[model samples]
Target: MSTLALGVIGNCTIAALIDPAAALVWGCFPRLDGDAVFPALLDGGGADAPAQADGRFALTLIDQSQSEQSYLPNTAILRTVLRDSHGGAVEITDFCPRFALFERIYRPPTIVRRVRPLAGRPRLRIQLRPRFDQGRLAPEITRGSNHIRYVGPAQTLRLTTNAPISYVLEERPFLLDRPVDLLLGDDESLEAGIELTARDLFERTHDHWRNWVRSLSIPFEWQEAVIRAAITLKLCQFEETGAIVAALTTSIPEAPDTERTWDYRFCWLRDAYFVIHALNRLGGTRMMEDYLRFIGDVVEDAADGSLRPVYGITREAALDESVVPHLAGYRGMGPVRIGNQAHLQIQNDVYGAVVLASTHAFFDRRMTRPGDGALFEQLERLGARAVALFDQPDAGPWELRGSAAVHTFPAVMCWAACDRLAKIARRLGRDDRAAHWRGAADRLHGIIRERAWNPEIGSFVSTFDGSEMDATLLLLHEVDFLAADDPRFAATVEAVAKTLRNGDFLFRYVAADDFGRPRTAFVICVFWYIDALAALGRRQEARDLFETVLAHRTPLGLLSEDIDPRSGELWGNFPQTYSMVGLINCAMRLSHPWEEAF
Candidate 1:
């Protein structure tokens, strides 16, 4: 008896039965970076359309019973477990080409599909459909008995079959049971096949991942979470320019009915600190070095000193947000956007993050000669910008709406900027600038302690005059603004723990005037708790809390920006890099206690 299971959501999904005899992947394209060929995942009509309408492809696996899915340890190569009811099993591995390192690179995109059946004899069925321009435009189809070519407005898609399987153009979903192999690309023919066993492929994939993971020097306790977080971090890095995106998808709401959806597909300067810290802990200094190089390139390429807070994956500073009204958002969030308009905002804190991250790189011995010089120049220019805007009001760390106010966190970050620059300048023999930066940092710290800190609340305020507590203040110890053991620090931590801690997770801030109950715990705040716990000599508690957060990771080992404490469903964008970065930082903090390391 054959039971068919079809899963359709967004522009990417897989459908198969429990036994995994045959599986179908729809909406996948030639490459991970390319647009979807089967837009059905985004629209219901595309899923019902014939594969030959344009150049869309459906992959089918046959002759298997049970199926499971996982990643190759620390890599993005997805491994699917296929087994027969009797006991035979196989594993299929899939990964898109990285940047253009492969022998054949498609201009648009191409997806690589490798199938192997283990134990018992498993037959596979494959289908290819290459849709163009979000499946809105049809392509000119050139059909052959065993091959097909689809030429579109800007790209060409070709599919060739190896096994005998009937190619039909029906208007509804159908099943293909026979062995069929096909390739989809512009001018290239991807090798497709149905192997009797996936043993060799599994072994190779396993070894590749194992070797890559072994390159990391993570401690034992945080190994699993670190590895997973590291892998997630790698997935967000655009290989072409080494720029890491904040998230993969856009329009996933931070809160239901709050209209908090924002595109996170661009690189953020704010992420620099967490990325560097995490990579440093993982002993993966290469990424930090690459980031420094990218920063230098952007500075050199830019016509002026005006820097953007975010940039495209290819290091392009231009990012204009536009909604795709044609398709509905995930779970009907509405206004599904592709690009981010946040780049247009002048976020002063980004300067501090960049300076702090560069300082981390320098101290970690990751910055090379010319890059060091470039970093110095960058710090100089950023210092000038910070000083010029130190008293001005602009978008703060939260990037809030309504008014651009003098945010406490951004001011603190500006302090970090000056502080890091002071140290670096001193090291580089620029004593005069170093002294100026140090004075600036000292004055900013004094101002924060005076104006931002609320004596009644005993914790740092969210804004300069706001009495509310912000989780971003939890980084006081992280940025060395205050000693972890300082009485004020202890008081602030206790205050947040009492007011903001919702079970193990923490809220971003507490609004004294809010009407509704406090929202779900922010995942990043939970990580901040772990950091604070570690800093406050609560090692065991920090470790336990860290594990508790890990338990919230989705079945596929992915993390969203937030999670419903009641239902435990993921909220916000899937696979958030910030969440992963927090995971990595907490792990490092737990593994290496501050007292001993600092």
Candidate 2:
């Protein structure tokens, strides 16, 4: 129970990861990329010690018997119900309150928990441990009449509650005749009665999310799953700045002892494009619009008209990679790395993501900064960069550091950039510019057809002059670089299926990466393969595989970034935006029509 399972709760300003028992194992303060105050998810990894207590905020129920978890119907709120053998039950509701307020989005840096006695009186203890600088230090706690303020170097946190402060502080069980409301924030005081304020906040939070879910264009089939995935993706967004992070926690390994852990708490240009695409399909346009502004800021500030693969939430350019020396890694795996070095890699695919993501602004009338002649000029610079780097060797989409190649994935993205820019040019009546970009696209298309294709292997490879294959090549037909019906595409699909596909999952690549060969399957790649299968008219098989992957999601109907292929166990960062986007996209593409269901 010490290991952090995949239940997550957030309100866009911040998020927390927990287990089924509702232990706060992993989360940051202030924002997604901030310091990891709860490092137990990493430090306590697979430790089976019954007394797990360090670096966690959890309800320590005394005389606990049975526990289970679920979400508050169509909301991001998490409910963990614990029952004692003596016929007493308690329900713990965890969420970060957010709703429309002051004619704007009200997403505060807060985490809310409400404990209620469901049946008879229940006894529980609250274990609250606040840390600083990724577990390198602890914050000083100063007590107040109704609250305790934990002042850290970076920020301050307040826990205001109705529960006895001494009981909570000493980790002693107390009878819960009624509900105890707790609010963790720094902005304001809850001078009003705790129960009254908490009840009102929970109601508003519930109403806000249920209404937001109502606005989604979810497929009729798998509606519940799609709704949950959509909520998780929205939670991953930093609404204040409109930046969508890849994942919440950092240094959760992709595979056991593989050294594949990464800090996914920052936004990546490539990942955002797919996120925008998935949300667009589900009719979640507000998120797309907010994210566009985030991307626009990055694009507008591009150094020398070139874009990097990743950027910080506040659009910070420099993210130096290092390890937190004090904390043990997730599952006792040491050397928990902080920050990311991929910021320095040459990922040419980002140029395409920039143009593709911005293309919506031109046509979507609802955009705040709708595309204009000036914006098109700004985007053209990115297109030119894509064309220039189309055939150059850089890090592939997987961010491989040990080697470089003229990867097929980035090459096709470069083609997509030219293709999209040409269409945009034509839309704006710039016929000359249209001709130039299209000509570039046509030339690159020819080059990819020639070099990326392996005549001997009877399929397209991961890179030009390479027989090696990676999961990203599954997207060849997705970008329209090749038609699904094209025999070449079919052969490429079969080739990747033979080499990278293992059972229902697909490996990113079997070739040894920086940490040696990957031992787990990336869930999103399987989604891409399923989409490809559906496109190729293998609908039934695709649907079956899709179901198997769906069953692999965490109990709370969410997914992490990676999964153990050998044991079918979930791993890596929590509530991965990429994985959730895959669920939404696949369900939309493969589900039976609403009319058919009826």
Best by TM-score: 2
Model 1 TM-score relative to the real fold: 0.83
| TM per prediction | 0.83, 0.98
Worst 10 residues of 2 by lDDT: 44-53
Candidate 1 lDDT, tens digit per residue, 1-598? 1111221111111111111222332343333333545543333223343433333344433444456776656665565666655555555555443322255211233334454456655544354444666555667777666556778777776655444435333223233333222334455543433232223333444555566578887765667778877766775665446677787655666666555667776788888888878887787766667776666566566444557888776676777877767655444445566677788887878778877877865566544533355568767787777766665687667665445767777787888888988998887788997898999989888987888878777777767876767788788889898999988887888877887787767877656222244466678888987898789998899888888888878655568787766656667765688899898888777775444654
lDDT per residue (tens digit) for residues 1-598 in model 2: 3443557999998898877766788778888788788777788453342444567788867777888999999999999998988898999999998999999978888888999899876788888887888877888888877788888887888999989998877777899897888898774688688788888888999999999999999897889899999999999999989999999888888877667778889999998668878978888888999999899889889746798889999998888899887777877765688889999999999988888888888777766678878888888889889988989999999998988989999999999999989989998999999999999999999999999999999999999989999888888888888888999989989999999988778999999878777888898999999999999999999999899998988788888888877788877777788999999999999999989987
lDDT of each: 0.63, 0.86
**Where does model 1 exceed 4 Å of error?**
1-66, 82-91, 98-109, 117-130, 138-140, 144-147, 159-186, 190-208, 301-304, 366-371, 510-518, 592-598
- Model 2, which residues run further than 4 Å from truth? 1-4, 45-52
lDDT of 1 at 205: 41
Judge candidate 2 at residue 513 and give its lDDT.
76
Best by lDDT: 2
Clashes (N, CA, C under 3 Å) per candidate: 24, 1
